[model samples]
Target: MSENETQAEVGTTRRGWTASKVLIAVVLTAVVTFGMTALLVNILERRTESAQPNHNVVELSDTTYDPAVWGQNYPQQYESYLRTEEMGLTVYGGSQPIELTPSETDPRSVGSSSRLEDDPRLRIMWAGYAFAKGYTHARGHEWMLEDQRYTVRVLDFNQPGTCLNCHASMPEVYDELGNGDREAGFDTVNAMTYSEATQHASGPVACIDCHDPDTMSLRITRPAFVTGIAALKASEGIEDYDVNRDATTDEMRSYVCAQCHVEYYFDGDAGNRLTFPWAEGNHIDDIWKYYEEDGHIDFEHEITGASILKAQHPEFEIWSQGVHADAGVSCADCHMSYDRSAAQKVTDHHINSPLFDANASCGTCHSDDAETLVNRVVTLQDRFVVSRNQAFDALVSLIYNIEEGMANGVDEDSLDLAREYQNKASFYLDFVYSENSYGFHAPDYTQSVLIDSMDASRMGELALEGASREDLEASEVTQKYAQDIEDRSDLEFLR
Candidate 1:
């Protein structure tokens, strides 16, 4: 009851409060110290692990065609590589598996959606060609060989061994065919029947195709790409350019993909030799010029007896026209973006669209969030689709007009001019269509291509209406170039 007793109680409370504050501070300090220590240890471990060499359980060689064999040495990369089998859909691209009833002829019970069925216009576009028979959506790298082997394009039609050049891992086949001379093997394999050449392919693309066995550095293994790049460089005034020797590491990242992703043709004169038409350049116009000079026709259009040039996937060429390539971003930078596996950074081998992992892919350079980046990509693609549809519709209208013209007994010169226009329109439109990017790779460039395609279709329509060749011809510059090419061709023929 005394004042002293009250003061004593107050002092006891103050002491207890001070002791509680000290206890809290000590616990906080210990927690902070522990976290910092753990973080430092983690950093050190990661650094040490990254610095250490990859421990190889088995020796790989040029003969090692199995990806599983490569997996033993670089498990992280191999693991990601195997994930290529995982199929899912993105907004614009990425494969979605479609279930199929396996038949004796085609043993696969699952496949991607048919592109031909998705757009019947493609059938008309590729009429009189195997592609019109059947063309399916592209699946992962793992399915490349299997899809090629059993597709109606190969099953119902006659195909050269050259078709297998990009579909399967060719190093082993090349070795077997050419007695260790890959170029010779490439020549031999390309000349064989698809059935015979396919017999030698071990599997889809493997490590040896893109990587050196000893150093694991990127290399160009495809002879076609080697010749293609050299020709492309030569056109740029760089004579005797060897991609394997001259390309930088960053350039190789894209060049390896360019091997199979660019437009190509079979040189019948050279025994169906698989060839990339980059002798002039990789641009659509340049490619058109090259084809014009070569006079290599794929097939005669069934609807309009036009000599047509088939444009295969031209991803590399399209991408080269994009801002990403301008910024020096490689294909591997996006589709095969780098990710950490435990302690080391490795390129993700599950090659697919950047949309699936925008943060890991696009986010590497762009500061935008994943969803925003994806939406930006989709917006570009949406615009591209609108333009593409317009161009495609125009092309289809021309095809129909040409058919009608033929039925109406149009003059041969008029019909021929319209057919030539159809060839350009179809090939240009198909170039953009076949490219997997859906115009996200180079939005403006892609739009320009579509516009040109639509213009070609318009010119074809005019030709059908009996427009003069002089009026229907391309721009002054293009006309001059065409004349020069014709002049050169005549000179060469004389020689």
Candidate 2:
């Protein structure tokens, strides 16, 4: 072909590609938009015969922002965005000034607990990872991105490209690093590090927390979830995540928040940063069952590269199985309760525990007095709290025993038993403690903790039996307790 003819062909191909790209971008941008956002309104209309208010929304005076824009489109959101900065020192769950201590709050926590006080089995379980270095719970979305940004040497973050999928500004990552190729951007950032990419992320969880600012619509910013859903569908030969059909409006209320609230982990083994084991189903048993069956997990130290299964907060999913979700209530319905103004309305974005505002959260639905509902939640919470309290104490003892076995040169069998006791016991207790809802509010989970704790204690006794005291002392996994790696023990590590 002539050079002129070749150039014409090239131009034609480029034009086709460009058009396809634009079309794809527009369609994708629309898919993730939030359906619950306040309806858009025309501001400059005179009191006329045809104008009608269709939604319950607040009336705006002239201009705070342009509704046509994305980020600036939601002034109500912008106004409520400031709540993240509010002081919640006293607010146990959602209050701002949350200074948590593993010891002060729950002395039986992983690092602080007496049960895991000195067991080295975890070192094996979390081999070659920072979790081995010592992991803590204060790492919220806000904190994880900060220190990681300033750190010189960062995490391997490469174990699963899926780790960085959602904990980022999807658009920005997709742009600077992704080269504007939607598919390529996901691949690039999926493989990027929290440390390397954090320099690019500065804002707290907000509009882009679970959405793309290019459109003021709710969108799934996490690739792991998006891909997970697709993979789940593929595995089952299904392809529908219209979030709408999966649940009710109330379920979406919480599922919307669950968009960020539930448990998840970087699946290094599969090289896929997958969400929980939900493909099998969504309850605690279902997810755990999926994990056990697929073995899709890190199973390694998150920091030092050990094998481990990092159980994220399964509150939303677990709650979905509870009376709240079963009754058709959502996390948003309670947490982001709504209020109205100028005939317009909006759900509060403060995002706090419902217990803080009983009337708005519980009273709105149940035909009970504020005190009664408060008592109901508290009663449920307290019931489990008691069992959990016992479980916590038991777990602490289990850790100490495992540490004792390692320290006392116990036999291999006994040492193994000690390790098992501590790991399972502590993990079980921590799982319940971490649930965002207090026990009464999330009863089954609370009960599950107690049951699991009992199992851990039982198994712990077996680990203690695995080793002779002398052998345990010689082992590296346990060397802290030179005395009494024996019969039943007590939890006293934090003290």
Best by lDDT: 1
What's the lDDT for all of these models? 0.84, 0.50
For all predicted structures, in order, the TM-scores are 0.85, 0.64
lDDT (tens digit, per residue) of candidate 1 on 137-233: 8888877887898898889888999999898788888998999999999999988999999888767787889999988999999999999999999
User: After superposition, which runs of candidate 2 have C-alpha atoms over 4 Å from their true positions?
Assistant: 1-71, 89-91, 96-166, 208-218, 229-251, 269-274, 293-308, 340-342, 369-372, 407-410, 417-422, 466-495
Give lDDT tens digits, candidate 2, residues 1-495: 343543343233211124664665456445433332423323224213343332223322211122212333455655664443333321234422223233332321111111122344444434444445443333323333332332222332333345454444345555557675645666665565554555444334545444433433455545555554554444456666544345445444554466556677655454444455567666555655676677654443322221235455667666755777667776777777777333445667766566767787776677787777777777776677678767766655565665566677767656554553455555556556656565644687569756876676756665567644455334333553444454225646532
Instruction: Report the error of model 2 at residue 115, Å.
Output: 17
Predicted candidate 1: what Cα RMSD to the true structure?
A: 17.9
Question: Mind sharing the TM-score for model 2?
Answer: 0.64
**Model 1: residue 277 alpha-carbon error in angstroms:** 0.6
- Per-residue lDDT of 477 in model 2: 35
Name the runs in model 1 displaced over 4 angstroms.
1-53, 340-342, 474-495
